[model samples]
Target: MIEVKDVWKKYKIYQDKPVSFKERFLYKRKGVFQEKWVLQGISLSIEKGKMIGLIGRNGSGKSTLLKMMTKILQPDKGELKIIGRVSSLLELGAGFHMDFTGRENIFMNASLFGLSRKEINSKLQEIIRFAELDTFIDNPVRTYSSGMFMRLAFSIAIHVEPDILLIDEILAVGDNAFQKKCISKIEEFKEKGKTIVFVSHDNGIMERLCDELYWIHESKLVKKGKPEEVIRDYLDFLSGSEEQRLKNEVMQQENQQTSQIEVTEQNEEVNKKENKRWGNGAVEITNIAIRNPDNENKFIFTREQRLEVELTYKTTNLKVERPVFGVGIFKMDGTNCYGTNTYIDKVELEISEHGKVRYCIESLNLVQGDYYVDVACHHEDGTPYDYITKAANFSVHSKENDQGIAFLPHKWFFEKGGES
Candidate 1:
């Protein structure tokens, strides 16, 4: 088991305006400087073989916590216990020497990871093959690319055969192929019951890989739960933060005591800027909005709510046949949530090359999250001519607060035979 008991880490920050020369001299000593707590009374435990994720925004003490786990940093007030052999990939090439050749550095680093020379010799070919650095193994470490360095570092970490693994965002550094390989290799370790703790900002991977997650907020452990639940809370917090920031800036500009005339002129200019548009030369999309059954602009809704998407488009050029309009919803990662087009229905009509058209999507089943709609106009022959990636963005605002690719309303029925 791994346990953290009210672990707190503190660092002394020198005052920028230390008054006297004597004060400056005392600032170097702990008693004079201001103490800031990075991790404040955090306590948690992990059963053996469980996979955990530590996540937060930048400067949320994620790095500090990971370093403490690896014994690179000590907590000021609390206990952290580890019962197994641990291998960490917190920083790439942390113990490597730039002046040494790659082979020499690998041997040195592997030995530091608790691997003997005999074991490293047995696994040398496998590690080099995974790293794809056989040709450069004889070259000095300074000559390797960042990708090469990451590959070698990851290869070394995995080859150590640790009972518990600590990984930071190092896997995110490599190419897509290497990243996939890392995911696969980590899954293999999970199958063998090796405990792993990961730190990353990639929510997709975190959701899939971690059984549980720790959320750090404002220098404290604010929440902990399944990955999906923590991510939902984090995203909601981010949305509120952005909204507050915008409100603060607007308030500051409005309250400035000087130049009332200039402020009025600035307001007018802003309105004009908002009204200006690069009207699509071929087609125009106007009045795109989403609504619930009552026909009000709403983001919150039940899965069964009558959802509708409405659009009005005008064409500038002649249309020999009914031009197809495509509407699609996309996830944050660019995957299409769902889409439909008139062309799929084989609708045909003759309209003037330049004319107006209205499209409405009524009662479509949708999952929850922040989704943006993409719109495109094309010919019946399937040639895209005009399109807009961000026609509008909206949140589904699910009531159930579930985590998934899609939420389906399902039920199970239990029955017993009636004396057949």
Candidate 2:
């Protein structure tokens, strides 16, 4: 179990760096600086056997709170208590010594976790095997790749079997297989009634693993409840409807001048063409378009309107069997709203030469915001044939004042009760 109350953290941001001792002395009194509070009166409690997930925007003090929980950082003013042994995986290669060999670092890290030499020896082989680093165990860790480093670090962390496990986003570094292995280990820990606090942007994984969710915004605790409810609220904030309105107002003012108007349009076109693209070239996506009910390609739509995504591609080979076509809708701030693939939907396609595929939605159901679409064609084995990031940009406007990315089909009902 872990408990925190009235936690506050603050840091000073320096405006300038002195280049020399003389400059430092001269500017000591005049240097500009500002105080930034990363956390303010934050309070939460995690029960002994429950898994909790943390969600927040980048730089919103999620990591700061995690560090405080792990005792790496002290709260400026608060009471904190933890009732168990703790293990933390905060950053990539955080606890390992760069100069030490992978073999040596395992022992060092385990020792820091409060294990004796005999205990380390008993679990040493299991850790190495889980990491799959037998070939490079004796090599200095500096020579290892990011995936190798994460594997070793994660392996050692779990083998220690602490009462509390705190994980950040470090799992993203490893490959798909290793990530699955790590998840399985976490599930095992949960069965053993260990407390886990995880921070991740992958909503699907969090919803599956966590018993509850905490939503943090701008260093304040926004909500704490079920995963679906908290995640929905977080996504709404990331959609940035108010922020986008301000931007549109600024653009309208600039459009009063013909010269400035043309420059803005040119920049928009450049941005559209600059979307990131990568693939093995087995198949290439030529174009992507968003269409409305009238089948007219457009970049904007209304909420609850019929929407379509069209993908145009070409296959290099004579016949490409079972090509997976996928689309992802993401808020401009990098929150994934929804994603789907033809394979997952039980649709099959075999393309030869050139082809066009379209996905139709009965109702867009998206709230008012700017969003980007990602399109990809890949093999069944997850090898990308052609993957495009932010391939198309679009905006959704709504007459209804909804608070989330999607509109659910629901109705409100009330019941009256009388004393018997």
Candidate 3:
């Protein structure tokens, strides 16, 4: 259990950091400083055995809050009471001594979690095996790569079996296989009713793993609720912010080149209905449609039903060569289902004026859910000419209910053997 009461944290920002004692003494009175509040009167109570997620943009104080929970940093004004032992994977090589051998640091870090030498010895081999660091165990940790260091730190932290676990996006460090292993280990911890506080930008992981989600913005708690609801709101907020930024950029460009170029006015109603759109303006997507196999535009489909996406656009440049068209499907809760581009599929287009591109999905295997589509036109090298997020919305209907987003074809068979 964790209880935070009216927590407030602030840091002093200095124009220049003093490097020497004389400089510090001289600048002590002359230095210009500004105080910025990273967290403002935050109050929350987390029940034991709950998996909580912290979601926010960068510099929103998510990591700062995690550090306070781990007792690495203290809030300037507040009370925090944590009832159980805690283990954190806050940063790569955070608790490591660079000069110490990997084997030695493992023991040292485990001891910080209150593990005795005997207990550490029993778990040492397992930790090494999990980190896949048998050969580098005796080598100085300073010689280890970022991935190797993360492996060792994560292995020790998870194996310690603390009552509470705090993770701050450090899982993004390793290779895919190791990341999977770490996720499995975290799931195991969750099954054992361990309290977990995770901060990650991976929406799918948060939606799948978290029992509750917290949205932080501008060093304040914006919302806290179910993962689906909170993540949807957070995504809308991001989309709105992106659209405003694009609008500002377009206005600035128009002001600078009013006579040289003509800009098409976008319909307000269409912009509101469609997903957020932005690009370099070399080409613009004029229309998008989600149609069924009959070529009729629709926003609903069923599992294994043929679906098609039609994209219409006009190029402002004289000629655009090898224009790659892309489409993506995402779950309503911000999980990316699938994405592909013309380049990847070996299709290319050259457009100097108006053109239409169609992408047909032979069979939609997605389960019953609301899904959104994204369309984009870009170069083969990934430079976007026009990009749209959630350009269209549709729903998939399925007679059979399934737990996950996708349904795969499979059959179950059993075998019986008689005594020989």
lDDT of 1 by residue, 92-161 (tens): 7788899897788879999998889999999888988999999999899889888888899888888989
Q: How far is candidate 3 from the true structure (C-alpha RMSD, Å)?
A: 10.8
Tens digits of lDDT, candidate 3, 1-420: 989898999989988767789988977864667999999887888898899999999999999999999998999998999989999999999989999999999999999999999999999999999999999899999999999999999999999989999999998989999999988988999999999999999888898899999898999999999998998788767656754664566558557753423334544335545647666768888777788778876665668789999988888896777788899999999999999998899875667587788999999999978899989998788888888888787777544557787899989998899679
- After TM-score superposition, the amount by which residue 108's alpha carbon in candidate 2 deviates from its true location, in angstroms, is 0.9
Model 1 residue 255 CA deviation (Å) reads 5.7
* lDDT, candidate 2, 118-176, per-residue tens: 99999999999999999999999999999999999999999998999999999998999
Candidate 3 or 1, higher lDDT: 3
Ranking by lDDT: 3, 2, 1
- The window of 10 residues in a row where model 3 has the poorest summed lDDT is 260-269
lDDT of each: 0.76, 0.86, 0.87
State which candidate has the highest lDDT. Answer: 3
Clashes (backbone N, CA, C under 3 Å), per candidate, total 4, 0, 0
Best of the two (1, 3) by TM-score: 3
Alpha-carbon lDDT of model 2 = 0.86
